[model samples]
Target: MKIAPDVVRAFTPTGKLRASINTGNPILAAADATHGARGVSVDLARGFAQRLGVELELLVFDTAIKSVEAVTQEQADIGFFAIDPKRGEGIHFTAAYVLIEGCYAVRNDSPIQANEQVDRPGTRVVVGKGSAYDLFLTRELKQATILRAPSSQAVVEMFLDQGAEVAAGVKQQLEADVLPLGNLRLLPGRFMVIQQAMGCPRSRGAEAAAALASYVEEMKRSGFVAEALQRHGITGAAVAPAA
Candidate 1:
C-alpha cells in the first residue's frame, strides 16, 4: 500500500515515530532496565516505524491510563491499547492484533469458585484503575464493589491489602503476580477477552488510521504477532483473528 505524504507527515511531523508504550500491562510491554522497555508491543512499534521510514521513539508509561492519555492527547503519534469505547473518543483503533483473557482470581480458601460467583452482593473485586478490566466490570457488575488499584501491576497487592474477595486483570499477569503470594487461585474460565490493538489519535485523520490498521492486519497475517508473542515468552495471549 502506498502511504500518502500527508499521512506520513501526520505520523512523523517531528521526523520520528513517537510510540506510547504501556509497561504496566506485562502482556504487551514491561520496563526493561537494560533496554528501557521490551515486549510484543515494543517489537510492533519498531516494525511500524520501519514501515514508515522513520526513527522510533518509545514514550514509556507505567499504567494503561497514562499510556492512553499520551496518545489521546497527541503527545505521541501512536499507542497500543485494549479497544474500549471510552478510549475511542480521541483515538481510532485498529482491529485487535492480540487477544488476552480477563480473569478473576481469589484466595484459595475464598468461596469464589467460578466466574459466576464473583458478582455477589458484598463481594469486593479489586482491579487496576482505569484498566480495561476496571472499565468493563464497572459496567457489567451490578452488585459487586469495584476497588481500583493504582496500576495493573499493583492489583494483586491491593487485593491482599484490602482483603478484597477477588482480583481481576489479565490472566497471565494474575498468574505471575500471585505466584509469590501463594494460596491464590484463578477462577475457572474468563470474564472477558481483551482486544489489544494499535491506535493513533483521531486528529491524525482517517488516512493515518487506515495505514496503521493495515500495518497491523499484515502483521497478523504474516504470523509476526504470533512469533513475537512466542519470542517474548508471553503466554495466555492469542493472536487475534482477521477482522
Candidate 2:
C-alpha cells in the first residue's frame, strides 16, 4: 500500500514514526530475552515505518493503557491496541488485524468449571488493569467483582495472592503463567475475543486514520499478518477476517 504524503506527514510529523508498543500483551507483543520488544506488533510497526519511508522510533511500555496514553497524550504518533469502545474515545482504530482469545481461569478445585459460571454475585475475578479483557469484563460482568492487577504480566500472581475465584485474560498468557503451578486450570472456551488493531490519536484526523486502516486491510489480505504470527512463534492468536 502506498501511503499518501499528507497521511505520512500526519503520522510522522517529527520525520520519524513514533510507535507505542505494548509488551504486556504477550499474544501480539512481548519483551525478548534481550528485553527489546518483539512479536507481531513490533513487526507491524517496523513495517509501517518502512511503508511510510521514515525512521521508526519505538516507545515501549508494559501495558495497553500506557501505550494508548502515549498516543492520546501526543507522546507518540501511533500505537497497537485492542479496539474497544472505551479506548475509541480518543483513538481512531483500524480494522482488527488479529483475534485473541480472552478466557477465565480458576484454581483446579474451584467450582467455576465453565466460562458461564464466572459471573456469580460473590465471585471475584482478577484482571490486568487497562487490558482488553479488563475493559470487556468490566462492561459485561454485572455481578462479579473485578480486581485489577498492575499489569497483565502480573494477573496470575495477583489472582493467587488476592484469592480471586476467577482470573480473566488472554488464554495464552493464563496457560503459560499457570504452567509452573499445577493447581490452576483454564475454563473451557473463551468469554470474549479481543480485536487487536493499529490506532492513531483522533486528533491526527481522518486521513491518517484511513491510511493506517487501509494498510491493515492490505496486510491481512496479503497474508502478512498470518505469516508474522508464524514467524514469531506466537500461538493461540488468529488473524482477523476482512472488515
Lowest lDDT block of 10, candidate 1: 178-187
lDDT of 1: 0.93
Best model per TM-score: 1
lDDT of 2 by residue, 68-181 (tens): 899999899989999999989999999999998998889999977888888889999999999988889989999999999999989999999988899888888898898789
Off by over 4 Å in 1: none
lDDT of each: 0.93, 0.90
Q: Please state every model's RMSD to the true fold in angstroms.
A: 0.9, 1.2
lDDT of 2 at 211: 90
The best candidate by lDDT is: 1
Looking at candidate 2, what is the lDDT of residue 182? Answer: 91
All candidates: TM-score: 0.98, 0.97
